[model samples]
Target: MKVLALKFENYRNLDDAIITPCDGVNVIYGDNAQGKTNLLEAFWMFCGGHSFRGSKDNELIGFGKPFAKLEVRFFGQDREQTASIKFKGNKKQVEINSVAKNSAAALIEKYCAVVFSPEHLNLIKRGPSERRKFIDSAICREKLKNAVVLSKYNRTLNQRNSLLKDIYRHPELEETLSIWDNSLLLNGAILIKQRMEYLQMLEKRAAEYHFGISGGKEQLEIRYLSTTNAEYGDSIEQIHQKLYETFEQSRADDIRNGCTTKGAHRDDAEILINGKNARLYASQGQQRSAVLSLKLAEAAVLSERMGEKPIILLDDVMSELDSKRQDFLLNKLDDCQVFITCCEQSNKEQLKHGKIFNVCNGVIS
Candidate 1:
C-alpha cells in the first residue's frame, strides 16, 4: 500500500496542509512540535481511522476550530483508494472513494498501515494491557471475528463488575451474575485462542528476525501466558468448560475484590533471550531489537496475508538509534513502502530518497 496524497484542515496546529509523498521513502524534516509527527498522525487516521497519539475526535481539531478533516488518497491491492474524515463536536464520519463507509473497521484492509514509534519500547517495560493491545491489534488485522468476541467479553465483564459492586445495595440483582459469567466464558475462550494463534506466529518469526537484527548473538522468544491455562485447539466445548471452571475457582475472590477476574484482560506475553528473561536481563539494545523484531514480524505476516507489501510508517525514530542499528532498519524497509520522519539537522545524510517535504509550525512548505 502507498499513500499518494494527503490534506488536513483544522487539525491541531495544522490549519490547511496538503502533501504528495513518493512511493518509497518520504522524509518529513522539521524541529520538535513543528507538526512532523502530526503529518504522520493525519495519514495514520485516514488509513486506519485511529490516531497514534490516542487523542479523541474532538481533540484532533485546532484550538479554536470546531471541526477537523483529513483527506487522503492511496493505492492498495493494485487499485487506488481514497478516504476522508470529518469530525465535529463528538461525532466523526468516514468516506471511502466518495462513498460513506458504515463502520471504520470495514475500511481496515483498504487503509492498512503499521506504525512504529519510540513509545513502543514500553511494550517490554510496561504493563500487560499494552502487550495485550499489541496482540489484539495484530489479531484484529488478521481476523475480524476476534473483534466481535472481544467486544462481547468486555461488555460482559463490565456488567458483571457493576453487578458485583452494586449487588449488596440491591441484593435482587445477584441472580443475574450467572448470565454474565456464561457470556464471559463463551467470548473469553475465543479471545484466548486467537491470542495464542497470533503469539505462536510472532514467536516463530521473531526468533529468526531478532537474530538478524541483533547480529545472531541474542535470541528472542515470545511466550503467551493465558489468564486461564488451556492450549490451542478447535474444540469450543472444551474451552468453555475450562473457562467455566476457572470462573468458579475465582468466584469467591472476585466477589470480595468486586471485579470480574480470570480472562484475557489479565493475560501477558513474556520475552526471553538466550534462556533468560528479556524484561529482566536483556540490555537496552536487546530490548530495542525485541520490539523492532515484533513489528517487522507483523509486516512479514501482513505481506503474506495480503499477498502484497503493507505500508510502514517510521516516525522520527531513527535519530534515537546508532549507526549499525540504523542500517538494519533501512534494510527491513528496502522491500516495502515506508514514510519516514526525521529532523533535518540529524544525520539526514543517512536517509535515502522517495520524496522530501519541509514542515514548520504546522505548515508544509
Candidate 2:
C-alpha cells in the first residue's frame, strides 16, 4: 500500500502540518532529534501498532498540548481510505472511514507496514524473546486469525502460571492445572506449527537477501528451536502430543518454580551466518545485514500473502552499511513504497528519483 498524505497536529515534536509523499521512494532527512523519525512513526501508527521507538500514548503528544491528532489517507486494495487517531491522557480513539473502532489494532486489516528501526537490532543482540516476537509479528500480519491464537496462548500461559503458584499452597487445587495445560497445549502447538511454517518461507527469502548483502561470501540460516522438541516437519498433531508430554514432564518443576518453564513461549530461533551463530560471532555489520535481510524478507512474505506490497520504513540504519549494501536498499527494492530517515544530505542526492522532505525543529518542507 502507499501513503498519500499524513496530517499531524500536536504529535511528538512535529508542528501541525500535512505531508504528501511520492508513490515510490520518499527520503526524510534532518539532523538528529529533529522529528525525522517522528514522520515515519506517524505513518506506522496507522498500521495499528505501537510506536517503533516504543513511546507511550502520553509521550506521543507535543509538550504543553492536551492532546494529539493524526490522520492518514492511503491507497490500498484498489481504493483510497482515511483513518484518524486521537490521543488524550494516555487514552486514544480511532476511526476508519468515519466508522468508530474499538481499538487501534482494528486498523491492521486496512493498513500494512514493516518498520526497521535501530532498536530492531535486538532481534539478534538480545535473547530469544525478541526473535520470537519478530516471527510472531510477521505471522500475525500475514494471517489475522493467528493473532487471536497468539493472544490465547499468552493468556493461557499466564493463567497456567497463576494456577501453578496457587497449587504450591493448596494441593487440592492442583487438579485445575490440567485444564490450563490442555488449553496451553492446544494453543502452543498451533503457535509452534505456524512459526515453523513462517520461518521456513522466511529463511529462503532471507538467505537470498543476505547473500546479496554479504556479496555472496556468507550464507544465512534460520532454525526454529521448539521447546517441546518439535522438529520443522512435525505435523500439528505430533506437535500437540509433544507439548502434552512436555507439560507432564515439567509439571513439578513448574509448580516449584511458580511459572512455566516450557512450551512455545520458551522457544527460540537461531540465526546462523555461515554455520556460526550471528548473535555470538557475527560482526556489527553482519548483524545489521542479517536484520535487514530478515525485515526485507518479511516484506516479501507479506506481499505474497496479502497480494500487495506493504510499505517499508527504514529509520536511521544506513550510515553503518557499506556502499554495496546501501545500493541494494536504495535501488533494489522495486515496486515497494519506502520511507527512509537519514541525517545526511548525501542520502537525498543518492535517490535518483523521489520526493525529499527536510525537517528542522519539527517543521517539514
| Steric overlap count per candidate | 0, 0
Question: Model 2 clash pairs?
Answer: none
Tens digits of per-residue lDDT, candidate 1, 1-365, equal 77888888999898596788877776777888898888888877864676887888788889998789989888887898788888897777889889887766567767777787788888987888989989888887776777878888888889899898887577677787898888888888888878887788788888888887767777888887776777665466677788888888987777778887777789898888888887788787778778888887887787777676777777866654666666666544567777768774543566654566788898887
> Where does model 2 exceed 4 Å of error?
none
TM-score against native, each model: 0.87, 0.94
lDDT of 1: 0.79
Per-residue lDDT tens digits of candidate 2, residues 179-240?
A: 88888889899999999999999999999999988788899999999888999899999999
Model 2 has an lDDT value of 0.90
Inter-residue clash pairs, candidate 1: none
RMSD of 1: 2.9
Task: Name the top TM-score candidate.
Answer: 2
Candidate 2 residue 288 C-alpha distance from true site, Å: 0.9
Candidates' C-alpha lDDT: 0.79, 0.90
